[model samples]
Target: VQDNLEGALTEADIEPLNMPEMDRDELVEGESFKFTLLCQVKPDIELKGLDALTVNRELVEVGDTEINAEIEGLREQNAELEPVEDRGSETGDIVTFDFVGTLDGEEEPFDGGSGTEHPLELGSGQFIEGFEDQLIGVKEGDERVVDVTFPEDYQAEHLAAKLAHFACTVKSVRCKALADVDDEFAVDLGHDDLSALRASVYDRLFEAATKEKDGDVREQLLKGLMEANEIEIPAALIEMAQKQLQNQMGMHLAMNGMPRDQIAQAMESETEGVLERAKEMAHRDLLLDAAAVEGDISVSDDELEERIGEIAVDMNQPKAKVRASLQENDRIHSVRGEMLHEKTLRWLEEQASSVSGDSTSASAEGNPTADDASDSNVEVADEES
Candidate 1:
């Protein structure tokens, strides 16, 4: 069988040829024709010594100082916005005020600039340039006018390159963050206490650091493997990718109630860009899969579940919803393919040579167990229950 397969593969051109011997009788059921397919394998690149593929490992050392800094960041993350008492508007202070603007000192061309108690953060660049700058040092019950110019390339065609003056009134000011990052803060975050918050923060930071470092190693290995391998990818794959992009984009626009003509016009321009990207991505996939198959690397179901769960967490969506969407869209298959690529890259990294920095090496003390790549391919539940 191996010899026959090899012989069949050798006869193929740059593109893969169908293998009639591998055809399944099931494919002949109903009105469909039956034929076996032998996907022409792209030229495989030989990966050498597990140690010869030069790579850099950030040899991260996670000590108490780093942990503390991470914890402090968490505290800032949990910081609260509170109304200020007896505070005036200053740079960086969020202000609620009423204002009107005029084009050439006249209100006729500047409608909609008038509002009561509008919220603006000083120095936030939320308003016209220099508008916020004028708000600095203004207290409640104060009023001032500021001169500014709209940029030549402003989005609003009518106002582009127009000079305008804002007639301003300061109503109230809210000060900087006053949230207490103590036990109360933890409770606010729905945790038991500050210690629990710290523990959670630590776990999150450790996971983030590990992921970043591992991803770096994997990317470097893939870059090397891609450079080493020669592969032939079908032009049809790029066309398919472009069509898929158009369909997805169209679906998104339709969901938002965009018009047909608008979508068609947009697709005409975007299709070219998408095609180029798809070609590059297809080439990368071909090489990665070939390298992975040679190395016997693959992803397990458990890893997919974990990754899906992580995506859900990041998107603030329910795991069940995400799982359903992935399954319905055939995205689960795509996810598996992505996971396979990641696994192959990691395997290459393991066999490759590496260097480390002092900061990375210093943080090597007592980090938790690495997310084991071997434990992948097993089914992982979205919830413990």
Candidate 2:
């Protein structure tokens, strides 16, 4: 009957919801249902030959300045936090203290806090605004009471704008980091010496930087394609993206030990913004798929398997387990979409002419835009709401 035809819908070029024929039936009790109906047909894109497409592969050059920065970063990561026998704790030094935080006349400590060896770095601004600054002059074995008011929009409702007193007893003081950036340091890092270490580090840095620059070019190319191309995306896909985004975010928060109540609150606060982001991203994806078809670029089965293996390696999981997880979650289509996007980006690079000489490089140290100041507020809203 109509049910059998509906079951075969996926086998056809069109989806079950987009089938051309409409069928209906009425039961004995007079209850009736529309059995099958195809709303519309999907548009097709004409393909071009690979010989007609010309994509330029970019060459990224890294110099001494970039090498030095890379080496410094690696040294920092491998840097040891050693104790200073003579020097006193400074702005960046770690300060171990036993503290009792109290509100009003009550001497009770904050929940999960009190008489503990809490590590605080002066001027880190990790605690309340004035909390760490007040301990600037205090040395080891010193006892003091710090009085401060929490921000008006603090995360904890009870602590918001509340005047509080923290009775702090400094247990020990640790001083300046004496990092060894010498040939001996390189030997300790499993290298022969400083020169060999620098060379190796430089090579790795150039590879990483070149790859990153290429990724940026690819992103710009894909974004341009998405902007130029126009297509109506299925509403089902948008809804799915929204729900998937929510679920993924929930899983991320759960992995970070966030409670259910906190996750629910975060979702309620972020739903609208998340949906908007998802909608834009989904539209971009649909346009890219169309572009992939138009360019006749595709990923093979081997390419897909290679991609899956790479993702599994990045996640520190076995390939079999990752494959099983993807199958169980029915995310094979998501993987195909990812491959299609990559192919589409390659196609865009082929179509467009790019002039790449040299542009002024922005420092990675500072904030990217003025809008980041507003983003800080949004982040607070996300955390507290």
Candidate 3:
């Protein structure tokens, strides 16, 4: 039924609310047949999508401070840990310890409050505030009681704002022996010299800044599109969209090693704003399609292939294999649709104006993009449900 609906109405974004009113058995080949479907469709409205949008683009300025920071990070990465024998432990020293955290007056440690052979850097804030402070002067093989209070809004509700005592055994202490920075340092990092490394770092940072600016523009344009257009979506469509969202989330979590039962339990416990998110996703897709039509944006075959080629490169796969996978999953059209959506955004970015102050473009109501949004007749077999 979905395939047929998409085949007949490519950009209609219609969701059928009921079975079609026509009997499939009664239809004859090569003859005109009409069926009625109670469809709740996307409304066509003028979008302020590609207009005098005001966005901000920060100047990509890379100073010596930033370059030196990057170089320091590289130095830290190349540094080795040297065992500390003279001093106990300092703010920047790495301490290996075993700890069992117990709430005040409790005998046994609370769940998830104990660890053995934990390596932590003092002042790194890996542990609670006072916990690290108390570990500051601890030497190897030392035993001490560290006291700290969890934050009021701690993630574990049971432990929030509770004063806990950690029985700690200091195992070892180490400090970073930072690598020397010189002409040889640049060669070690695959650069000709320190100057070349600085230049490369600046170029990388500038490119990242450019992408971030483009992202901001796209976000602002989408905001303008949503604000300038008001489309009434039906409840059935929202329900369908919510299911798709849940499935997508489930797939993502499963891919990340989350147990299916746990995922279901988590989702069940946190469904408050899922409907709103689904509605927003649906609304965004509809508005993007309308913007594409307004911009006359079309994705050519070669363009789609080239985009896939880029994806192939990024994923380290053959272009043909990627194309085949997308085809097998019937996501090729979705890729094209995304391309159209991106093209529309790029066009809007081109038309946007950058200013120092925060400004938003306004749009006026105009003619609908298609025929008046009405309940179109559609036909489906009862068994199809």
The candidate scoring highest on TM-score is 2
Q: Which residue runs of candidate 3 sit more than 4 Å off their true CA positions?
A: 1-35, 48-50, 234-278, 356-385
The runs of at least 3 residues in candidate 1 whose Cα sits more than 4 Å from the true structure, single-residue gaps closed, are 1-52, 61-87, 98-117, 125-129, 141-147, 150-169, 177-199, 230-233, 239-279, 298-328, 357-385
* Cα-based lDDT at residue 288, candidate 3: 77
Best by lDDT: 3
**All candidates: TM-score:** 0.61, 0.75, 0.74
- Lowest-lDDT window of 10 residues in candidate 1? 376-385
* Ordering by TM-score: 2, 3, 1
Can you write out model 2's per-residue Cα lDDT over 1-385, one digit (the tens) per residue?
5566656565665653233566566645765545655465444533233223323445566555565566666655665566644555668767889988888667677763365788887877888998888887677788988899989876455678988898999887765443456667668888876666666765576567667877777666655555555566666666767888998999998998776777888788898999887887767666666667676778888888998999899999999999999989987767977887877776676676656533223234222123332222111111110
* lDDT (Cα, 0-100) at 190 in candidate 2: 88
For every model shown, the clashing-pair count is 16, 1, 3
lDDT of 1 by residue, 1-385 (tens): 4555566556754345233336545544466544445454345555433345777777655554565566556554544445655655677677788877888856563755578889887887888787888788877778888889999866455678989877778777766563445566568888776666555655676667777887787667766765665456666565666677778888987787756776676667677787877877776777777768778887788898999999899999999999999999889988889888877776676567666652234344443332321121112223210
Predictions: Cα RMSD each: 11.4, 10.0, 16.1
lDDT (0 to 1) per candidate: 0.67, 0.67, 0.73
